[model samples]
Target: MLFLLSPAKSLDYETPVPAEVPATIPHFEAPRGPSTELIRLLREKSPQQIATLMHLSDNLSALNVARYKAWSGRSTPENARQAAFAFDGDVYGGLDARSFTPAQLDWAQAHVCILSGLYGVLRPLDLLQPYRLEMGTALANRHGKDLYAFWGSRIADHLNERLAADRTPVVVNLASQEYFRAVDRKALKARVVECVFEEWKTDRYKIVSFHAKRARGLLARWAVLHKAATPRALEKFDLEGYGFDAEASAPERLVFRRKT
Candidate 1:
């Protein structure tokens, strides 16, 4: 089973990566790559345009504008950090890639895939540069008026290729709906399973954005540390205070609930 995750908007490029962790190039950043094409378009937008497009403050808009201008065609150790370590948000907070050992990171690199607006799909160890682009962004490109239209079936095709060797070829969807929408379901060749994390709010179990995001990361972390390969193994996930809700789970949707 391959686990899907969403890229965090908040980034941490200041921390030093461990000497043991290695980085690889993103698939979409190859020569004449999709990312390169997208970057070319992003470079055209002025800081004010970016601010309006992404609804950012002056400071944030200027920062990203500079990032777009400074982006290089090639990723280097000096310019990039591993994707898992670079992302810093609620989802990544639970992931806590910093604590992972070299062996665990190696396993995560193969089993985990992070959905991105710019790079498409990123493995845990893929080299990443600092940037802020959400999947829902309406960045017009040759493909269409939005990033989703631009991505089309490319994301699903990539996932299919990666799952070709797997016996079951199951895709565990831990990504937010915005990012997951980029993966064309018709083009994908795997059984997609959605994991729902709910919290006991007031009188019932309800989904909270912050807690759910962190739970997704916790689940992903559990899968990596345990080396969970089968869907059955995932049901056994009981990290943080969460417990699998057998009654609430369906064949395609697995629900985990927690009471705090």
Candidate 2:
């Protein structure tokens, strides 16, 4: 089974990745790759244009502008870090890749894939440069009006290729709707199973964004630690007080709930 995740806006390049943790270039980071074209378009935009386009403050827009300007296709230790270690958001906080052993990271590299607006799909150890582009961004490209159009069926096709070698050939979707939309479901060949994490609200169970995001990472971490290769093994997830809700779960949708 392959695990799907979304990229985080928050990043952490300051934290030093262990020297033993090896890194690889992104699958689509070639000389004339899709990212190169997007960077070329982004380079044309001024800080003010970026501010308006991405709905950012003046400071954040300037920061991203600098990142774009300094961006290089080369993947060196100084310019880039592993994707899993670089992302420092809620989901990543739960993933805690910094604590993972090199062996565990190797396993995650094979099973986990992160969807990105700029770099299509990324494995755990894929080298990542600093940039801020959400999949929902309306930056028009050669493909169409939005990033979704830009990705089209490419993401799904790539996932299919990765899944072809798996015994079960299943995709566990832990991504948000925005990023997942980039994937053309019609083009994907694997069975997709979405995992929903909910917490008890005032009256009943509800999906709180923060808890849900963290839970997704927690699930991935649990899978990595346990080497869970089958969908059935995922049902055993009980991290952070969560329990599988058999009543709310279906074959395509697995629901996990927590009292807190």
Candidate 3:
């Protein structure tokens, strides 16, 4: 994962990739991970204080949440997934978490996965901003449930603007599905944002997104698991296109302009 710190080095991948902003995105590339002092400050502060800090200064931003937290090689994106799997298959979850319900996890995972939103584990740098700002604002307002809802809305807006600027398709997560579906969609002919996930057993779950009404015959049924799971190392996965696991749970739905 340390190698991912330099975006230039990461650009050599074979797949067509999203335009990145290395500085802003959180990855495995910080000077000291996180300091003990920072975690103490965060733990002591109220959510409102955290939110205010997020909006006012970069010093105590939400991105700092996982700075010092430790991750094993399985979750590190280092040590090549194959080796991690060979050594500790259960840790990295080669089959993806979709096989289990979010409710079934332990306190730590519930805090990290459900509450902390994986603390920028798999997300890219540029993509983190919209969600970060949205979460910060919502936390400040004390509208907790609305965090995801508001995040979805703001992300949808950001995606709309990015799409209009370029006709490029990129990888996104299930967390943003509700948001993307809320777009008014001004003039971007190519409206696809490939969603990457892990099915229960294994492999990336692929979701193809577009204006649901317009996608009609282009993708056959409204939803289906077109690409099955993959075996081998983590790098063996294909992350460059539209995909989703139809067999998994229902994605969060985003309602756009409502009609009577």
Give all TM-scores, in the order shown: 0.98, 0.98, 0.25
Model 1 spans with C-alpha error above 4 angstroms: none
Cα-based lDDT for every prediction:
0.93, 0.92, 0.26
Superposition TM-score, candidate 1 onto the true structure: 0.98
Ranking of predictions according to TM-score? 1, 2, 3
In candidate 3, what residue range of length 10 has the lowest lDDT sum?
A: 1-10
On a 0 to 1 TM-score scale, where does candidate 2 land against the true structure? 0.98
Q: For each candidate, how many residue pairs have backbone atoms clashing (under 3 Å)?
A: 0, 0, 11
Candidate 3 regions with alpha-carbon error over 4 angstroms = 1-22, 25-145, 168-260
Which stretches of model 2 miss by more than 4 angstroms?
A: none
| Residue 190 local lDDT, model 1 | 99
Look at candidate 1 and give me any clashing residue pairs.
none
User: Residue 83, candidate 3: how far off, in angstroms?
Assistant: 24
